[model samples]
Target: MSWELVSGLETHVELSTNTKIFCGCTTKFGGEPNTNCCPICIGLPGTLPKLNRQVVHYAIMAGLATHCTINNVSKMDRKNYVYPDLPKAYQISQYDKPLCEHGYIQLDNGRKIGITRIHIEEDAGKLVHEHGDTFVDYNRGGVPLIEIVSEPDIRSIAEAREYVEKLQMIMKHIGVSDCKMQEGSLRCDVNISVRPEGSNEFGTRTEIKNMNSFTNMEKAMAYEYDRQIDLLESGGKVTQETLRWNPDEGITTPMRGKEDAHDYRYFREPDLVTIYTTDEEIEAIRQELPELPDARIARYESDFGLPEADAQLLVKYRKIAEYFEAAGEGLANKKTVANFILGQIFRTLVTDEEKENGAVAIPPEYLHDLAKLLEDGKIKMNLAKTTLDKMLETGKPCTDFISEQDMGDIDEDTLRTICQSVVDNNPKAVADFKGGKDKAVKALIGQVMKQTRGKADGRKAEAMMVDMMNDME
Candidate 1:
């Protein structure tokens, strides 16, 4: 019998606060191990936790962005657990009284995936194991996190990946989180099961824990889906357990038995009282939110005349989208600006070194000017691309390089002279064009451009070359 996959995700997004959630320790990504920790974060004796107001504000912003209803009063609870990375044997998190609930994220196909809740919690420490020794770093221990739990509405691996990518884009656009998978800022736990097609009863589910990359998330889900289906088809029972995805081997290995909520022994924390928010405060935050990805995409398509695909690409990154809008403002042919950014500007950022450090060196104004030059036909596309490469390498304005190289449209007299030379030099090409081979003129125009160092206007030179070829005929 054929089976269908049912999946949901529990995403942990690290908030972009300067300090840890309940302590004054730094939340920076990389530092000397344990140096970013403090008494409260490290769970030292005699230390009390104080909540960060910014963390709450950010949580509310996240809730609002995802259409979640913000809770007026939420309380922190102690999630009792024992782990080497969790300095606090019992983690301070939200249990029954989470900050937000009942939200949804709409996929591009208009399918709405329901969100169960979004709760604020502190991150656990990092465990670095090398040569039979395990080292714990508390630098990330108290970093603020918002765990977004989705419903089991996801049906396929592609939907699972799209859901995560869309969430990453939204969070990044709103400046709530960087959502960098490499830095461990954004991570996911996938709960998936398989059931017979058209059956209401769900199969035994398995949890894939702490997948950091979206690609890995999809791969892991795909592997688990097959594993469950194959086991049931072979007359074996699917077990409920936690699994780890080995990307190197492309398989999911069983980690441990899955634990239910009651297993954690969750209870309300006594140290922190019930947190509260007012409608006025929520409204103020809602007003302060920037244009989200959806609105920006709509504006790009309707106002800027961009195709939906191009608009989606431009808005994929917040910084890139803002740069595109700033440079393309008041310019004719805004689509040209989009193309240059996605094509030439993106190509220049080749190496990771160039991408990390050299991207900001070349100003957006250079791109704007280059697009303008192309739009006005002052320089053809081939010359513009060469100048763009040099601009990226030297961080100089496009005009300065254009002037130094004397790059501009070749005069009509010079273009005609070059075309005549090309036609005379290739009698066979001239005869081909005259014999009704329309494409042969392109070769003659290419010769003119080569002679003029890409300074000749291609359309004008093509016309000139056709005229010169006809004269010989």
Candidate 2:
């Protein structure tokens, strides 16, 4: 039987607060292990957790951005669990009284993924294990996190990936979280179940973990779907368990059984007071939200006349979008700006497949200047590309490199002179061109391009060659 994949995601986005949720410890990354911990965060005796008011404000902002109904009163509950990484032995999180509910994000296919709830919680510390020894760091403990739980509205790997991306974009645009996957500021756990194509009931769902990037998220979910489908087809039963995605191995390994709400043994925190927010406050946050990505993408397509594909690609990074708008300002060169961004700038700044850092480091303003220079015809296309590569290396603007090397486009007179020389040097090509051969004219243009060291615009040279060859006729 052909099966369909059903998936949902529970993403934990660490709020970009300056301090830990309950303590005064810093929430900055890459400090000495356990240095950011305090009695309140490390769960020491005689310590009590105090809720961070900023965390609630951020949570409400997130809810408003995603079109969720913000709760007027939300309480914190003790999520009882035991793990080496969790120093508190129980995480202070929201259970039944989450801060927001009933949100949705529209995918590219125009289907909305329903958000079940968005709740605030504290992050657990990390475990470092090597050579049969293990250590724990409480630095990450008490870092504020907003866990966004989505319903099983996702039906494919593609949909799952889009939902995650949309959610991340929402968080970033609203300034709720940095959503940096490498720094563990944002993390996701995917739940997948496969059932017959037309069945209404769901199959046993397996949860996948350890997905660090969007590509890995899509790939791991696809691989797991195939794995589960193969097992079910061969008469093997699907188990409800937690599986870890080993991106290196490109496979999912069974970790443990899945846990339900009761497994955590949640209870209201007696020490912390319940917080209440007003509708007017939530409305104020709603008004403060910046233009969202979807709306921006639409405006980019309509206002800038950018193709849908190019607009979508450019809007993925807010830095690039801002750069595009700035470069396009007051210049009557919108198309040229779009072309440079979608064409040259993208090529030079995105080398994820070849580079170790997985991203290019060219400054945004430099890209803007490069596009402007190209629009003014100040440099040949080949030279612009070369200048861009060098700009990526040196992080300098195009004008600096061009002035240092005197590498602007060759003058029209100099181009014609080089074309004449090429035509005079290639007698056979000239003779063939006079004999009504257009291909030989291209040959003469190639010679001019080679003689100029690829600095001449081949189109300009080709036009000059036709004129030069006709003069000999």
Candidate 3:
């Protein structure tokens, strides 16, 4: 019997605010275990909680970016739960009235996974089980979080991965969160189940708690899907429980039975008033939003003439996209700026984390100046590339490495003579290029570049060589 997979993701994004959601505690990532905490964040008595105004603004921004309808009025509720890491034994969150609803994140394959709700909540602390002893740290407690719950519209692991990726990209681009999975700023809980193919009715589903990385998410979901199908095939029942993914052992271990809404015992909070937003407020926030990834990607392709893959890669990270936009400002060849970043500048920051951090030392104007030289026909691409490497290495301008003597391209007649000499001297390379080894022309161009001291344009040199080859024919 064929079985199909069904899944939904509950993603928690830590807002990029300076303070905790309901207190003045610093929301910095790392500190001495409990040094960053205070009375209100740890729920001390006689201390009242105050909601951070920036948190609400960021939540609304997240809603607008994801195409969700922002609710004008919403209130906070106490979510009752017992946990060692939660100082209050109940987290402040929303139940019936959330900030955003009925949004969807579209995948690259044109599939829209419906987002159920995006609600603001407080984060719990961390528990470290060391040497069979448990230790708790309350530093992360009361941190602001926005829970993005998606409808069970995901039918495969690819959709699940893309959904998370799209969310990560959107949140980062909107400047609300860094969305770093490794830093615990972004987390996921996946609900997965399997049913007989072509069946509409849902089956018993188990939740996988806190998948941090894409590799783990994919592996855990695939394992759980197969596990459910096998159980159903053997006439065994699929249990509704929350499971922990053991990455080393590659299996899902049951943690506890799944709880419904009533399990939380939610109630309206007395300390906080209802959040009200006027049309003017929402519109004001809307106007503050920067260009989102999809829109920027489209403009990069349509206006800047970048390939889809290049445009997507550039827009994947906010800092890189910003740098590219600034570097390519008022330039005729925008792709040249992209090439400098993707080709040479990226080589300096070899890791994705480094690239995402935009660690390239050279300023955008340095690249813009170098590309400008290329544009004005004053410098060949080879010289521009070499000068860029120097600028990146020394944090100097292109003029620092390239002197006035090296600033001019060879005249057309002079370039024609160099090309003829290259063709005549490299008879074997020319024969190979004529015999259909297109890359063989590089050797001929190398000779011309060497003779001209890198002042000869490789493209024009190659074109002149092709013209020479045509004359021979």
Candidate 4:
């Protein structure tokens, strides 16, 4: 019997607030291990938790963006658990009264995956183990988080990955979270099971915890789906447990038995008051939300005439999309702008400094000018690439670089002279073109472009060279 995979995601997003959810401690990542913590975050005696107002606002914004219904009133609860990373012994989270409910995200194939709920919670601290000793850092203990739980509607590994990616893009566009997987700002826990094809009954499910990367998430799901199917086929029972993905080995190892909700012994917290919101406030937030990925992609296609693939690529990252819009503001050929950024500009941003800072060194105006020049036929694509490299290296304007380096497109006279020189230098190529070897002219055009340092338009030069060689024949 064939088996079908069913998966859902529990994604945790760290809010981009300046301070922790219930304390005044800094929520910045990568500080001295224990320095960013405070009494309330570390759960010191006589300390009480106070909720951050911005966290609630961001949660509401997230809910609105995902089409979730915002709860008028929500309260916090204590999730009783014992772990070294959780210094408070019990974490303050939302149980039955989460902030948002009943939402869905649509996939590219037009399939809609239901969102169960989005709840606000505090993050646990980090436990670093080295040299046979474990060290606990409370710096992240009280960071605000929103847990987006999806229904078990995902049918394949590709759907699962796309769902998470779409969510990341939405959150980043709204400016609620950075969603950086490497920094632990965005993490996913996948719950997957395999049942017989066309069966209504679900198979035993296992949870894969803390898949930080999309590549790993897909790999782990593939591995786990196979593991469950193999067990069921071998006449063995599939166990319910939490598993850890070993990326290097490409396998899922059992971590521990999965715990149900009752295992956490949840109860309403007494110290903090219940949260409240109004329709006016929700409307205000909805007005402040930026255009989401799907809407932006549609606009790009309809308004700018960008292809679906190109529009999707631009809107995948909020910053890149903004850059494209700003630079291509009034240009007729927005596709040219998109191609230059995706092809030439992206290639120069491979350094560690650029990646960490999340910026392109070249200014947006310079990019706009480069695209305009290419569209106007004032510069060849090859010469534009060269000018772009120099602009990126020096952070100078494209116009200044092009002027100082004399990178203008070669005039028709100069281009014809270079094409003639190339044709005279290559007798065999000239003979081949005359003998109806159509591809031989490409070699001659390349020679002209080389002689002019990529400043000559290859199409014009190809035509000129073919004409010159035809006259000789």
Candidate 5:
């Protein structure tokens, strides 16, 4: 029997603030293993956890950015559990009293995914397992986290990926979280199950953890869906358990039985005071939100007259979108700016896979100036690429770098003279062009570019070559 995949996600994005959520420990990743821990974060005696006001502000900002109803009052609850990672044996998390609720994000296909709730929580410490012993690092124990829970509205792997991507972009654009999955800052837990199409009741779901990257999230969901379907077809029942994704094996292995809500034994923390927000605060955060990716993508298309694909490309990153907007200023042809941003500037920085992760440190204004130079035709497209590579190397503007290196575009009169010299040299190619061999004309163009040291405009050279060759014919 065929089965329909059903999935939901719980994403915990570490807030970008420097300090932990409940204490003042440094939240910076990759310190000397456990040096960043402190009394309150590690649950020492005579130390009490104090809420980070910035974390609350960011959580509300995230709520507003995603079109959620902000709860004016929220408080923390202690979630009791026994784990090697959590030092307190109970994570201070929000249960029924989340900061935000009743939110939704629209998918590209026009389907809206309902966000059940968003709560503020503290991250647990990490466990490092060695051959003979295990170590605990409480550096991340009290780090700020926003747990975004989505309804089981996703039906396909592509939909799940899109939702996660949109959420990540929104959070990044709002300046709340860095959402860097590699640093364990941003993590996702995928709950997946499959049932026959048009089934009223949902099937048992398995929770997959440690899906640190977006690609792994998609792969894990797909694998779990198939695994559940195969089991049901063979008269095997799905088990409710916590599964670990072995990215190397591309499969989810059952780790242990899932913990229910009562397993945590949550209760309000009497040590900390209740949190309250006023309308003024919500309005303040709402007004401070920058233009999100979806809104910016629409503006890029409708207002700037860019193609849908180009708009999507430019608006994917907040930095790139701002650069494009600034470069388009006072320019008659916004389309030209769009082309330069998408084709030249972004292409230069995102060359290798590592660069795609923001490795290359080329400044935005440098790219803006590079686009401006290309717009003015002070440099040809080929020379622009060379200038870009150099700028990427030295972080200099294309104009200054080109002037310093004397890599200007070849002059038009000099290019025509070179074209003539090319026609004079390649006699066989000229004969072939006159005999109607269209491919033979490219040979003359190559000769002109070669004679000019590839500084000539290729199209102009082709035109000059065509005209000179036609005169001989």
Candidate 6:
């Protein structure tokens, strides 16, 4: 019997607010344990928790970006729990009344994963286990976070990855959070269940706690799917439990029984007041939103005549998209700009972090200058591309490497004379071209470029060379 997978993700995104959600403590990462803490963060007696206004604004912006409806009135609730990391025995969060509700993030395949709610909350501290002792760091405690709950719309591992990646991109684009998983800024709680194929009813679900990276998400989901299928096949029912993914052993161990809403013993937070936002305020925030990734990708394809894949690659990273536009300014063929970014620039920025941060040595205007030279026929692609590499290395302009003679193309008559001389000099290649070897013409063009000291346009020369070969008897 074939088993199908149904999955939903509860993604916790740490907002980039300067202070803790309910206090004025700094929200900086990697501080000494308990050093960044204040009385409010450590839940000292007689301290009142005050809400951060910026947290509410950033949450609304996130809600708007993900196509969610912003609730006009919302209130925070206290979720009671006993853990050393949560200095406050009760964490302040939103339950029934969240800041944003009923949102959906659309994937490339036209599937909209429903988001249940995006609520403002405060994060617990880090529990580091070393040498059989658990040390608590209150630095992250009371840090602002917005939990995005998604409905069980994911069916496959690929869709799960896309959903998470889309969410990550959206959050980063809105400038809400860094979404750096390594730093615990963005983490996912994956809820997975497996049922018989073509069945409408969902099987018993098990929750996996806090998957940080995409590779781990994919591997963990795949393993959990197989594990559940095996259990069902053996006539054993799966348990409803919370589990942890062990990357080293490639298995999920039971953490504890799954907790429902009632498990938390929720109540209204007495310290914080109700949050009320008006429609005018929501619209003002919506206006602050820059062009999102999907719209930009569509525009790149329609306006620049770029391929869909090319557009997606450039638009995935915020900095790369901005750099592409700035570099493409006033250029007739924007696709040339895309090619350079997707080709040469991407070749250097190999890692996702480097690409996401736009860690290129040269400025966007430097790229614009290089693209202008190519469009104006001042230099061929071969020379422009090589010069781009040099620019990337030295943060210098193309003029530093391209001389005046190398700037302009050889004259038409001179180019043709050079082409004929090359054809005569390389009869074997000409014969190879006559015999239907299409790549042989490249050798002829290579000679033309070499003879002109990279001054000749490789593309134009290729076209002219191919034509001359076709006309040969």
- True-structure Cα RMSD, model 1: 2.8
Compared with the true structure, what per-residue lDDT tens digits does model 5 show for residues 1-473?
Answer: 67888888898999999899877888898888789988888888788889999999999998988889999989999989888888878889998889999998899999988899999999998888899888998888899999999999889999988998899889988889878888877898998888899897899998998789888888888788888988898899998888999999998998864444237778998788889999998998898889888998898788878898888877667766766777677665678767755665566565523333444346566766766676776666666776677777677776666663244677788887888888898899989989999899888876765565456788888888888888884
Better of 5 and 6 by lDDT: 6
Instruction: Estimate every model's Cα lDDT from 0 to 1.
Output: 0.87, 0.82, 0.92, 0.89, 0.82, 0.91
Which stretches of candidate 1 lie above 4 Å from their native place? 131-133, 257-262, 351-361, 377-379, 403-418, 431-440, 450-455
Q: lDDT by residue for model 2 over 1-473, one digit each (tens)?
A: 88999998999999999999998899998899989988888898899888888999899989888878899998999989888888778999999999999999999888999999999999999889999999999899889999999999899888888888898878876778878888888889999999999999999998887577888888888898999999999999898888898888989998865453238888998888888888888888888888888998899888878888888776777666777777677665576677766775676665423222224456556666776676776666666777777777677777766763345678899888888878788899889888988899877766776676557888878887887778775
Count clashing residue pairs per candidate.
Answer: 0, 0, 0, 0, 0, 0
TM-score of 6: 0.93
**TM-score of each prediction:** 0.91, 0.83, 0.93, 0.91, 0.88, 0.93
> Residue by residue across 284-346, what tens digits does model 6's lDDT show?
999999888888899999999999999989888999999999999999999998998898889
How many clashes show up in model 2? 0
Query: What value of lDDT does candidate 3 attain over all alpha carbons?
Result: 0.92
Please state the error at residue 9 of candidate 4 in Å: 1.2
Predicted structure 6: lDDT: 0.91
So what's the TM-score on candidate 2? 0.83
Report the candidate with higher TM-score, 5 versus 6.
Answer: 6
Model 6 deviation from the true structure expressed as Cα RMSD, one decimal place: 2.5
lDDT of 5 at 107: 96
Provide the lowest-lDDT 10-residue window in model 4.
349-358
Task: Look at candidate 2 and tell me the lDDT of residue 450.
Answer: 65
Model 5 lDDT-worst window of ten: 352-361
Cα error, residue 156 of model 3, in Å, equals 1.1
Ten residues in a row with the worst lDDT in model 6? Answer: 256-265
The pairs that clash in candidate 4 are none
